[model samples]
Target: MRKWTGGMLILALATVLFLSYNFIGKEPHKQTAYDFFHPSNTSLAMGSSSHAKSQQRIREKPHLIDVQGLDDLYLSLNMSEEESRSLLVWAQMRPLLSRSDALPDTVEGIKEAATAWKELLSVVSDTRNISDDDPGWKDCPHTVTSFNGNLSSNGNILHIPCGLIEDSSITVIGIPDAKQGSFQIQLQSSQVLGEAIPNVILNYAVHLPGDNVTDEPAVIQNTWSNDLGWGKEEICPDHRSNHSIKVDGFVKCNALVIRSSTEVNVNVSHPVNHQSTNNISVGSGHMSVNFPFVEGNAFTATLWAGVEGFHMTVNGRHETSFAYREKFEPWMVNDVKLEGGLQLMSALAKGLPYSGYLTSVLDIEHLKAPPVLKKRILMFIGVFSTGNNFERRMALRRSWMQYDAVRSGNVAVRFFIGLHKNLQVNLELWKEAQAFGDIQLMPFVDYYSLLSLKTISICIMGTKILSAKYVMKTDDDAFVRIDVIISNLKGMVPDGLLYGLISFESSPQRENDNKWYISSEEWAHDSYPPWAHGPGYIISRDIAKFIVQGHQQRDLQFFKLEDVAVGIWVEQFKKQGRKVQYISDEKFYNAGCETNYTLAHYQNPRMVLCLWETLQKEHEPNCCE
Candidate 1:
């Protein structure tokens, strides 16, 4: 038809210009004010009730500038210069139009306020030719005024003020400047002390003593005051802010201004009895001092007065003397009785000052003695009593072997008795001398001749008493040092062999009862024989008569650990060629406690009273006087 009606009128004019450009670029429908004060849109524009009384008279208008004085110029800095030339002549009579423009409801609003007063005089002549410094002039004289108005033809409203000057020269306009880079400055005030004191003073003085009291002048009183409040006519004993002073009932006083500071210190707290009355003096009115009686009763003074670059006046005073007097005594040991060992040998001769020949061999009258022993040694102590304190273990083994054989002038001790309910002269529980002694009480002896006569009567009285050239045996809590065991065995083995302490093995079958067990199958025949354990054993005297003539044809038996039955009779006298030696040089168990042993064993009675107080305090001399 006419080219399809011009292609259907160009597709209906491109769908009506794309629906009018998507309805004018969408994004707007947000009306509410209750849909513009709906009463159904005021009754659909109220069939015109005078257009709903002119829209409720423009929503009851009446806000004529009162934006709550725009939060008082945040922090003013006193501005001025005639309120900055009347806010640059009110922003040069404002008028850059466009605030929906319609405010000229009159004489063209005076040509839009004369073209905003020529553009606020070209922004105050470009803020006075900007060369910096001039944050609106500050030398205090505040100002910050602003104003805007249009309110109709599309709203507008601003107005800030904050201008000050007043001291009655009147200016004051404060309150305004609702933020957005606002300004103002100036502040000052603080000094306190009732504005630096002008009236408050006090001073006093007093002294009395022409050899004791009364010369009149002495009643100085103003007890106390702090932050002022009492006596001396409501504060004034020299501005009574009392620092301290109290003098009551006296016996000592020579001079006293009791309280007047600038610099003073007199403290002598009592202790000098020459019949009381001391002295002190200062002047500017009554003086005559002599303070010196310090024996006991009480004294104190410290004054540091004032006036010199201001403030300083301390005072503390006190003086009491109830007629002083003191005397006491009693403690004298007549200059250290007996010159206490000549003052510990003159403090070890001035700390060891012996220059040569050991100072004549430490002169104890040129010492000489210890070195003499021509045989005569016999120490034997063997007690195996079977319980109930056998006569308190034979009177503690005959009083410590007659006090170590009369303090070792060649020892000689003996005791070989073991009666634990007899086991037939216990000779080694027989079984060909059950390899020797009651091998740990053979299953607790149910009598086998009471373990063969207590093991062949202790192996024939321990080989006829360890045959003596130096025999020891032991056990009454063995403790023998008979002069360091006969002076270390006549000075280190002076003839033949035999010392003691040998324990190759025999800790009683790691003991833990089987009546004090001892079973490695009764020491499974020989594994450690060179022995020594019979509560401290020692020998020599011809190996104690060859073990008492080899226990006269062995038969009696009973060990019960007599040092592993004397190490199986010294391993059967070393297969009869006689040689049982293993004395790792003496020191047999100080199982007692403290030691350096020449011999020791069970020791008790508190280790013989701590080895008789560690040998009378290690060799007498006022042994712990």
Candidate 2:
């Protein structure tokens, strides 16, 4: 019994071993799973209907071929045979197969079987080649051409020629499937021709200088013979590019020369018909020549002569000679001699054929006339007063008053009064008003009164009451050049008008004291009209009368600063349609001791005295001498 049981076990084990070896060693049947699951295969099919459904699902609804992956698969299939083969091999080798160890004979079957083998070899190769220097060869040409196979480094569609493989037979073995689409290609070349040159046409016009004759057009023609032939247009396109066309010729006058033994001053007149209206002077020669040619223009010539009597010939033609027997009168020449001489030349050259070296001469006289003279007078003189003291100011005043009494001159002068006395008076008033609770009114009243008094005093005394053309009022300490002031005023502004040193308003600040302030009531107006400051300024005769008359109507009040008061009064007059002109050049109260100032104010007494002396020596030298 034991032996029989052991034999059965041994036979069963041997049978299992034989079946396993055959299954492992034999090539897989060429039939795919679909053949076994087909509805027509009944012997091996149990639940064949269900199996058919499973096979349909695997073929028609493949889960492995998702939308994204199917796109790549389709693109691979559409590639060239070599490219398709390469892709299929790469995809198959990416994942190992369970059943096949050897490749298949058919293209599709071979690709499927080779996938597992290729994947294994690729893993081993990648692992062996990996190193610190290359980091697994991330930027390898294989991968770059795979995913971005159609794109260049600059992100443009790449156009690769199959012919390039002849030189370098490199192939990308593994790659991501390419996107499927219709691609466009554009080819271009890199050579160009230069721009063509253009044709140019030049037009020219000519004129004669110092002659009022209108130019007459002259046609210049050139004809070339076959022997001296000009080249064709193509050969000499720019033939006249730098060539100049010059017209040169001469005009002749049949003039007669007069000769005498003594220095007989003779005047010869041509008949009206043969007269050359253009005048030419005779200077100890057979003919007086005049060349009337402009630069690049036409030329003309005139002829005359001075002598007692002489014969003249033009181009080998003879003219009659004359003799001066009586004393010559320049106004009345011998008409019979003149007519005979002109007629002889006209008859000789009436139709004669001649050219080259044409010359002529005529008798003429040098007539002398008396010289004429022109006179100039002092049309206008502007006076500006200088000197500070009441006596000196009066002297200037009296001198001007007398000068006006004689010549009625226009004058303007200014006076400089120190602000110390006014400031002292203002302080006293402020102290007095403070005791009465009127301190706020003190500053306004003192400043307003002080300004009004200074301006009104000048208007009354400094200007001519009625006769002056213009009057300028300026400070006594100012250095002024009356001549320069008059000349500049005559050139720039000639009218009798008031002028001033102008100022524009900027930020308001008081440097005298922190307590000083200006109320809104003081500068309520949006803008101040232009007016002259009293330090140095001008007043026209008409406006001077208005200001003087305005003061007469009421007693003039005082203001601390004369300029501000003048601005206020001028503003009043401006409202009445009278305007003040601002003079920017005439600097007023320029704060320098040695500058060439038009006017300098508030200077030291010693400097002012020295300036007066220097100006008298420099400008009034005649008076000092």
Q: Distance (Å) between predicted and true CA of 5, model 2?
A: 99
Query: Candidate 2 lDDT, tens digit per residue, 1-625?
Result: 9999999999999998898666434333443222322223123333444654222211121112112122222222233443222122123221111112111111222232233223323443453443324453221011112122233322221221110100111111111111211111111111111212111110001111122222211111111111222111110111122323111111111122222112212222222322211122222322112221122322111111112222222223332222211111110110111110010111100111111101111211111111112121122222221111222232233232223222222332323221111221222222222222101110011112233333443444333322445556554444455555566667545343555566545222243221122233333345444555555666655555556554443222222344554555555555455555656554554444434555655443345555556665564411111
Candidate 1: regions farther than 4 A off? 1-372, 380-408, 412-470, 475-522, 525-533, 536-540, 544-562, 565-567, 574-625
TM-score of each: 0.17, 0.28
Candidate No. with top TM-score: 2
Worst 10 residues of 2 by lDDT: 198-207
Q: Which one is best on lDDT?
A: 1
Off by over 4 Å in 2: 1-449, 462-466, 492-496, 506-518, 551-560, 578-580, 616-625
lDDT, model 2, position 116:
25
Superposition TM-score, candidate 2 onto the true structure: 0.28
lDDT for model 1? 0.30
